[model samples]
Target: MNILHLSAVNNWGGGENQIELLCREFKEHYPEVKNQILCKKGKLFHKRLEKTNLKFLTASLAFQMDPRYIRRIISICKKENIDLIHIHDSTALSLAIIADNLADLPPMVFSKKTSFPIRNRKQSLYKYNHPKLKKIFCVSKKTRNVTSEGIQDENKLVTLYHGIDPELQRNLKPGLDLRNFLKIPSERKIIGNIANHIEAKDLQTLVKTANQLINRENRKDFHFVQIGGFEKPRTSSLLQEVKQFGLEEHFSFLGFRENAAALIPQFDISIITSESEGLPQFIYESFFHKIPVISTGVGGISEIITHKINGLLAQAHDHKKLCENILILAENEELIPKFAEISHQMVLQNFTSEIMMEKTLIEYKKILHERL
Candidate 1:
């Protein structure tokens, strides 16, 4: 089975990480099923793919509906004999649909990695409900449920939780020392977050939460460390807010670190302040690292994290509640290990790359078999 994966995004994030993980899994365990990737040229995903052994092609996407990009997709499908096209993002799906119209291409599968509601527009509905797309693999149950509203054929929406590779997690060496890098004292507890400066991440709330903990609550022993890309407008706004709140010393933003998961070991507690998600990879990574988490109960987060069981939960934008949760972990350090152990066991039992890929392969085979 030859599969071509398409990613239209220009930056590196959790969704991009999943594509790499899926392809790596296929290469190591299911070598019989050959996989290749086609991504936007001159972008971060293309650049990152250069370091890996994965077979890939790049096309210049000058605009959303670039005719040149569509032609390139058609040419590759014919040249490579691609059995299926796994579209990784919404833009890629649009490009694929256009290519399909111009030529009879292979069936397509889309991975809905976010829980954002599909826009109620004619074009959006047409692209999402297009008959060429055989399956829509949602990252979490919440994602699947949200997607079902937009999709005409409910059968295509499948909830497939992407997970961490235990072996990879164990092998990853600690890359950054938070204390040394930030010049923070060893006595200060590190609260770490792995997310880009995007609207969905609600980094403003993160800044507010930090302010509550540091300035309002007068907790001088806690520091916030964020690792992700510095997107424009949002990053600038977040920095200003942090400054305005006098959180300069309390907060540190490490822009876009490769293998950022390695730094999780340095965190006393992990956090996700997203207003929306399809279950961030950081959650699974934190679970594997045995780092207790405090996150907003949005998207599929509540599906995995039982409030006060494996982790603490807060409503989106509720910085006050988030501040309280942080204090809970800091005051009672014993709960840290307890939550970590339970979360770690959960990852081992239900969430692993092996399980995720196996299920994916089953779906792939089923689709191919039905086509045959």
Candidate 2:
């Protein structure tokens, strides 16, 4: 099937990474599926996609709606003879909807990557109150609930957990030299947070939780290493917040690392303190590396970290519970293996790129069958 996968960004965040990985898998596993990606020109992901059958088209969008860009996208879709439009974010979805109308289009699907409340209630209503959308491929149930609440096409929403290339992840096994690169001691117990410094990610909660551990005279050896970037304007306050808390000495903000999976093994524990998320791809990466995670219960996080099984979960925004979980993981070594085993099994069984691609193909075929 001919397809156009759309995304506005080319940066290295969870959503961007997810799109890149999906494109890569589509190219590798489904060669018959001719696909192109519509994106802003000259971005990192746009450049990276040069290596695939997925052709790249440039279309600038303002937030989730821009008429001029949508017109351009529609013209391109018609010229390319596209059969499916799969959007990775809202901005792309806006353009896709316009293109669909113009080209007498095929099926359209949006990959639900985040729980939608972050978009103000008014904006959410304006953007999602559509019936033409064929399906929503939610990466988690939490994301599905949020989208279903705002969208009229409840039956079209399908919960499909995000997936990664198990082989690629397995090849990048965790090791100790990552600590050496960070100038951290080989023996210091490390707690890592791999999230962009955004309000939705709750970096403040992560830092506060770290401080709570630091305040404990008994747990001074625990270190906090944050692995993400602040390229976006919304996250400008995080650097100042880190300084305000006097966490400069104990906290390591490594910006964005391309080889994050390689570094996962160096840290003794991983944490996700997001205010919202879909099923975070990092959770699967952590399990792939056999590193246990302690995350706040939000979005579809609970779908992966099944409390006391794969990893620990605390209530969202609750720094005390975060502190408690971190300390418990730090103190008890036996609990680590149990969590790792369960998580590894869970990811291998349910969340591999192979499974995701198969399901996505099925969805595409189903949509086409309905049109026929």
Candidate 3:
């Protein structure tokens, strides 16, 4: 079962991480099922792939529908005799659909990793509902539900949650002493967030939440640490807001740490202020580290985090409610361990990379069998 994974994005994030995880899983457990990746040249995903033993190819994507990039896809499919093409992002899907139209290509399986509603445009509708896409693996039920609206064949939409490798988490050691590096007092509880500086991440609300905690609530013992890529405009905007709110002392933005997950253990709590998500990888990593979480109940977050059971959840953009949840975890120390333990158990039982890959293999086989 030779599979070619496609990633058209230029940056590294949860979706990219899932591709790496899926490929690694196949390499270790199902060696017979070979996998290769074809990603945008000179990008973060391409760089990360270089560190791995997995087979991969790169193409120069100057534009969305670059002919050269499309030719590379067709050539690779023919040369590699790829049994299937697993598209990782919407851009890749668009490219794949074009390549399929020009030449005979293998069946495609797309991973819908975000809950963003599909655009109602004719092109968008045609690309998603293209008959070549045999399966659409949604990262969460909410993603699947949202995707169903744009897709014609509902059977293709499958809810397949992405997960972390617990073994890797268990063995992961902190690459840096965050408290020492950030010069945070030992007495101060660290509130950590791992997300890129993007509009969907709602980093503005994160700043507002931090302001409420430090200035409004007058809580000086809590420090907020954000770790992710420093996307322009958003990063500058967030910095200005942090400075404007006089939160420089309370907030630390450690832009794009490669070892971000390793720092989870140092966090007293984990937070996600995203207005939209398929489900961030930070939540699963936090579960493995036994770190309590406070997040917005957007996308598929509620599927894993039952409010007040395993974690606290607030509505999107509601900084006051987010602050209240944070205070709840901080003041009630007993609830901290309680929530962490429950979440830890949840990840072990259902949300591990091994479990995810096993289910994925089943789906892959089913798809292949149907073709036969």
lDDT of 3 by residue, 227-285 (tens): 99999978999999999999999999999977589999999989999999999999999
The total of clashing pairs for model 3 equals 1
Local distance difference test, per candidate?
A: 0.92, 0.77, 0.92
Q: After superposing candidate 3, which stretches have Cα over 4 Å from the reference?
A: none
Q: What is the C-alpha RMSD of each candidate to the true structure, in Å?
A: 0.9, 2.6, 0.8
Better model by lDDT, 1 or 2? Answer: 1
CA deviation > 4 Å runs, candidate 2: 51-54, 61-68, 101-103, 117-131, 173-176, 231-236
TM for candidate 2 is 0.91
Instruction: List candidate 1 stretches off by more than 4 Å.
Output: none
lDDT of 1 by residue, 1-372 (tens): 999999888889989988888999999999989999999999999999999999899999989888878998999999989999999999999999989999999998999999998899998999999988999999999999999998899999888999888999889887677899789998789999999888999999999999999999999999999999999988999889989999999899999988899999888889999999999999999999999999999999999999989999999999999999999988888898899999999999888888888889999998999999
Give the range where candidate 2 is weakest over 10 consecutive residues by summed lDDT: 123-132
Winner of 2 and 3 under TM-score? 3
Global local distance difference test of model 2: 0.77
Task: Give model 2 RMSD, 1 decimal.
Answer: 2.6
The local distance difference test score of model 3 is: 0.92
